[model samples]
Target: MILVEGIGPLATIQDLGRPGWFDSGVGVAGAADCGSLRLANRLVGNPEGAAAIEVLLGGLVLRALRHHTMAVTGAPAPATVDGMPVGAASLLELEAGQTLRLGLAETGLRSYVAVRGGIDVAPVLGSRSRDTMSGIGPEPLRPGDRLPIGPVPPAIPIVDVAPVATSTDEILTVRALLGPRDDWFTDATALFDGEWAVSTDIDRIGARLDRRSGPPLERRIRDELRTEGMALGSIQVPPSGQPVVFLADHPITGGYPVIGVVVDADVDAVAQARPGRIVRFRPAG
Candidate 1:
């Protein structure tokens, strides 16, 4: 078991996600930076999709109730166990009663912590992920919470340390495929010419981009769009002309037209982009 001593602004339990339920109005809510979560679990000898803690901007502290192996990944944050420094993406052993601390992220926006056996939380809708937008699954973790650790697997972790990407770039280049509704816009391809800034209004639901370069995207048609299924990284351009990139907790159905869809390979970078960071789009073949 692990005791939460102090938690950061937003900390929640997440796995790969609850898939195949979109038709029932359930969005796929999981770790915003899934690549980081997978890496952390791999370091601890757990399944890639195992439930783990997603820490936002770090500043998290926890105490181990029993000896356990753990790993931290994602954003470049300073971590320490009982006053000793530990590197991200490296396996570390925690003795019972030892306190583990994570400092604020130096670059990216999210961090992931994974224990050897994963967090043994009760699954909801076949997932342990907390959907902040839909109010589904586990509640946000808080102080005094006692998280049970699942039984460890017999297999041992082969790697001691692994290198993971951390966002430190001022401008992020994301590859996107042109649309399910590109015809709705007058100049859908023009969106690639100007740079958009990441807005402060970002969450698991979506990332709103600031149209700093020029006017909002011009629509060729003024008719209301029928509600359609949305996917992660779907770039929906609303009436305001500003583009909103759907994330893990985005609505299952949206009325706005999606001009483009960011490739799955680049979604992790979108999760790490900070507010005011410049974002440029490229056509994905």
Candidate 2:
């Protein structure tokens, strides 16, 4: 067992996510940057889809009740065990009664911490992921919460550290595929031509962006789009014309038109983009 000593604004347990429930209005709620979560789990000898803790902007402290091996991945953050500094993406052994502290991230926005065994939380709808939008699964972690660790695997971790990107580039280039509603806009090319700035309006649901140049996309068909299933990375354009890129906790369906969908390879970069960061989209081929 591990005790949560402190927590940041948003921290929760997440796995690969609950899929195939969108028809029932359940969104796939999981880690914002799943690649990082997978890497952390790998470093701790856990299954790739094991549930782990997702720390937003860092600032988490955990006290171990028993000995355990752990790994921290995703956004680069200062980590320490009993006041001694430790490296991120590397495996570390924690003795009983030791406290682990994760500091604020210098570059990305979300971080993942995985133990030798995955977090043994009760699953909801085939997932341990907390869906902030739907209020499903466990609630956001808080101080004094005790987390149970699953049974550790017998196999040893193969690697000491995992190589992963830590910084968001000066201009985040997200590759996108033109969509089912591309014809709704007067000029879909404008999405690639103009630079967009990540707005403060970002959450698990979506990241709202403001186009730095060019006019708001004018709909060729002014009629509203019927509600349809929305996918992760769906770039929905609302009446205001700003593009909102759906993320892990996006609604199952949306009424707005989706002009493009960010490719799976580039979705992790979108999760790292901070407010005011410049974003540019390119056609995916």
What TM-score would each prediction reach against the true structure? 0.97, 0.97
Superposition error at 200 for model 1 (Å): 0.2
- Candidate 1, residue 176: Cα displacement in angstroms equals 0.3
Question: Cα miss at 33, model 2 (Å)?
Answer: 0.5
lDDT of 1 by residue, 1-285 (tens): 999988889899999999988768898899998999999998989999999999989988989999999999998889999989988899989999999899998887899999999999999989999999889999899999999999997769999999765445788999999999999998898779888999998988889998767545899999999999888999999888889999888898899999999999999889888899899999997
| Residue runs of model 1 more than 4 Å from their true location after superposition | none
lDDT of 2 at 274: 82
Cα lDDT computed for each candidate against the true fold? 0.91, 0.90
Clashing pairs in 1: none
Candidate 2 whole-model C-alpha lDDT, 0 to 1: 0.90
Tens digits of lDDT, candidate 2, 1-285: 999999987789999899989778888889899899989998999898999999999999999999989999988889999999999899989999999999998887898999988999999999999999999999899999999999988768999877765443688889999998999999987889879999999988889999897666778989978999898999999999889999999998989999999999888889878898899899998
Q: How close is candidate 1 to the true structure, as a TM-score?
A: 0.97
Q: Which runs in model 2 stand beyond 4 Å of their true positions?
A: none
